[model samples]
Target chain A: MTRLLTLACAVFTMTLVGCSESGSGDDTLTVGFSQVGAESGWRTAETESIRSEAEARGIELKFSDAQDKQENQIKALNTFIAQGVDAIILAPKVETGWEPVLKKAKKRGIPVILVDRGVEVEDESLYVTLIASDFIHEGEQAAKWLAEKTGGKANIAELQGTPAASAAIERKQGFEQEIAKHPGMKIIKSQTGDFTRSKGKEVMEAMLKGEGGDEINAVYAHNDDMALGAIQAIEEAGKKPGEDIIIVSIDGVRGAFEAMVAGKLNCTIECNPLLGPMAFDAVEKALAGEEQPKRIVVETTIYDQSIAADVIDSRKY
Target chain B: MPEALKKLLWPLAALGVLLLFNTAMNPAFFSITISDGRLTGSLVDVLDRATPVILLALGMTLVIATAGVDLSVGAVMAMAGSLAAMLLVDMQAHLSAVIVLTLGVCALAGLWNGVLVSIVGIQPIVATLILMVAGRGIAQLMTDGQIIPIDSSPGFAFLGGGTFLGLPFTITLAVSAVVLTIVVIRFTALGLFIESVGGNETASRYAGLSVRGVRLSVYTFTGLCAGLAGLIYASDITAADANYAGLYLELDAILAVVLGGTSLMGGRFYLAGSVVGALIIQTLNTTILMTEINGASVPVEYNLVIKALVVFVVCLLQSETVKQMIMRRRAVHD
Candidate 1:
């Protein structure tokens, strides 16, 4: 009985030692990353980039997938806090309902870095910085490109994303704002595609029939998937997609590049998902007690048919 | 009218009203135009888009008639699409192999639900709900959560976007499946067995019916139907998006079955009614998409509200109590 008791004590002590060793080390930075689940190709790419970047930087990343539930994210945040992680990187599934858990992390002096998405907290200090693409800017770039491509006059058929989505609303706002400057570039028809290829095709087909078949000259989709669907619809209608109805969309996914290469898509604005290097840079700055900006907008690029072929291979997502 | 034809009246009427409203709104709503050796128009679009819902409702009708509901049909669609995409694009497998393996896996998924419900004696809803929740996750795992775009499979594309005899291939597939199901169920003793089993499982068992086998067969058949629907849907988009493929379509199927006058409690089933029910839904969607009020597309928020109102009216018209109430009110007024 004494031997058994001694064995239990030794095991317990070793476990405690092991746990402490993993919890923190003098030189190693442990970042607890709460991801918003593998909801899409974009999200999966973001997660992969973050993981690889963490490995390259020699930082220990404690990863947790929230599987698209806000509750799971809050639970992950609490677990990271309990483990005394050096920093917390959260790609929140939703914008709201994060204040209380973020407050707890703030009290522990752990800087939270938002990736790909941001949170809505009363106190801006809850997160050190937000590293995300400017959706509205992407829309402006698309509109500016279209205006130039069409010589500042075109009938644009806008394919919005899911209604009420931040990306959809912001992109629409930016595109409309920029297009308003061009008096002849009118939005003839605007409809929601719900951010799916099937709906995009279906809605585009109806739009073509509702307006006379040859009325609209351009389609502005919120994402590449929708743009691709629109291409099919345009082809089915006996109209050349890229030539007859200039197709432009956001999200520089590989599908967009392929469409551009095939001469079906005119242009696509990049909503860059590779934020790992920049996110780590933010983490380092925050840990060193440097003041960080409230939001760090990742630089984006516009890809047209001219550059699509050369850049297609390098595009990750 | 025959009993079956009578049951289809409400759904057909509702569909007719929607079509009339659409024609009034857009003069080209019913105009079928020949383009690129195939039919192209708003009406054809409605039929093409209705393929998935029609297929799902066909299977859902049988399952519901067996006094069991399969909630996993939508998730099974995602699984099948994911498998097809992964095989065709990622593995670069042959189109025939991809089709066989995808349908096989979907049937097995249904058999899993059947085993849980019939063999283990669990409630059908809870048994099928297991797959409904986990099926999409399994699909995501297969594709590594990527939207697998099938860019080069013209042979497979024929299932979704090809034309046959100047008609959308999808429309032909849906019609053949519906007709085949009807012939198999109505001409054989299978339909009677299903209705008997659904009417009273204990009573059917007493009468020497293999209740377990009937339940298993119906669930498996439903799974097969969902697999075909998934294939068509993925092919339509030319990609397999595990996240959104057939998402919430199971509810649409259930609504279709109900709108076709199938009771939730089970017993009677209507195959043709279910097809019309599916058409009603697709027509509603196309109408909403085509309708432009004040030069702006109809608010999507009102789409479901209008659908619900139409469904409610159809159900009310089919209700015996409601019919009696209306008749009594009319007589009193007279």
Candidate 2:
């Protein structure tokens, strides 16, 4: 009898707590965020930014990690929909296969915000806005800097990312188109580095021994890790990287800053990953029935050796 | 020639054909120069980059010779690299301490898989599959899902990037490890024991051989080789990327073992053959990167397709039945 009475009191106390939570009305917003897995330092930093931002805003956030799988992301979205969340933020792993689940969210009248990467849906109404850095612009920026630094004359060795990836395709296209503007700038040796440091080093080593090895004057890598790897290869080949061969790459990660400070890397185009404030602001506007634009492009910054030492300390990633 | 010597002929011929083709296409492919007191050439790069795969194949050869496979070698690499980076970068441990602790943990990980396979009676594939998935997760946890850079350590970088007598230090490390392994397995009766267990496990057990002990030893040894490889890889890049450090490299190691004429059914391993097989793969990669047509590197899309065709042709050439069919057809035409 005593056990039953204690259980009754516990249940009565939980019910009272639940009643007070709903009694507080809808001022407290609950949002769900589905993140692609922590595949790189940039990705981890993005996730950290979002989580801390949610905490600061006093919003109840339900976060899910997809581990780089589309199916897992879809499952997270369905769960959020079942719970009747006020909003959903998805960092899609790929560009396709999100139409059906996103349509389900639309039926439930919940707004969706796409972050970092977007999905291909036939219905634009499925998502309120997409906030991401422009990859092609990043490539164009690297080319422009290299052209300016080299005075429009250089034989470049290009260290590309993985084959057929969207980033690789767009970056190659952008760099080629921009470099075509200056006839003196030409890519003498180009190969895929697969966006990893080791492969980058190996490819650079091979290309350094190939024809035009001596004539190469500049290096353009799709990411900072590859540029760093190329730096090692260039150093081993008895060439000064930043001085003898101007080097520029995308992804303004912290390691790039260190390399710049050491005078081993020339410049890095910033692919800023801090999107927390913008995502939350968009969420708030959507909640208030305010119309948002179809897309939001985050501004980027280019970092060179001149400011690397000053900016390295404040870099979050 | 003896049977052992004859078995090496196929892989050697394949490697020779590739080198000849590369030389014909690019006259500078064979040229070597001394820069910064280190050898610089396509050939040296091939040997240097083949170090990790060569080491993994050596371990994989022993495991396959025992009629079992360890799918977790790649994951073990990730774990070992992550541990080393954490110890050196985060905990600020000494280089020697970092090496010993990282390899020790990897061996323990292999021992765990052995216990599950030998004692708990789980299939080797399923048992190792558990660690293959969870090991990467454990690695990410150790690094807090960040790529840890181990910079400012010339002593550590020497393992992968330093030069010894104008050749990469990695080549020397891989060669010495392969030689030591060969001596240990061949000079001792361990070779016979492994063959007996894999040839017929119940028969070996009835013949008073400890099957479980042999399996345990092979797995532990493989774990140690993978740890060494992980160190070389992280040293080469000077950073530990948990997600892509040894991604899908287990398949490369297995392919190298099979290409060396070591059957997956497990018996009669060839250490030299595995080394040559790894060279073949690396040479293929170097060739692809060095080749150019119309003033541009071969479209990156054709790379894997060409690799697949070449590997398929080599496998077909290695088969005895196909050889007989070709010989018979030639005889008929004559």
lDDT of 1 by residue, A1-317 (tens): 99999999998787657646766657889999999887677787888999999999999999999888989999999988877788999998889999899999898789999987888888999999999998889889999999999999999888889888999999999999999999999887788888988889988988998845468999999998888888998888899999999989998888889889999999999867788999999999999999988999988889999999999887666
Top lDDT: which candidate number? 1
> DockQ (Cα-based) per candidate?
0.60, 0.64
Off by over 4 Å in 2: A1-24, A55-58
Best by DockQ: 2
Docking class for model 2 is medium
Per residue, candidate 1 scores C-alpha lDDT tens digits across B1-334 of: 8989989988898888888887788777888888878888888888899999999999999999989999999999999999998888878999999999999999998889889999999999999999999999898888877788887799888999999989899999999999999999999999999999999999999999999999999998999999999999999988898888899999999988988888888888999999998988888888877788877777766767877888788889879899899999999999
Give all candidates' CA lDDT scores.
Answer: 0.89, 0.88
Interface RMSD, candidate 2?
1.3
The TM-score of chain B in candidate 1 is 0.98
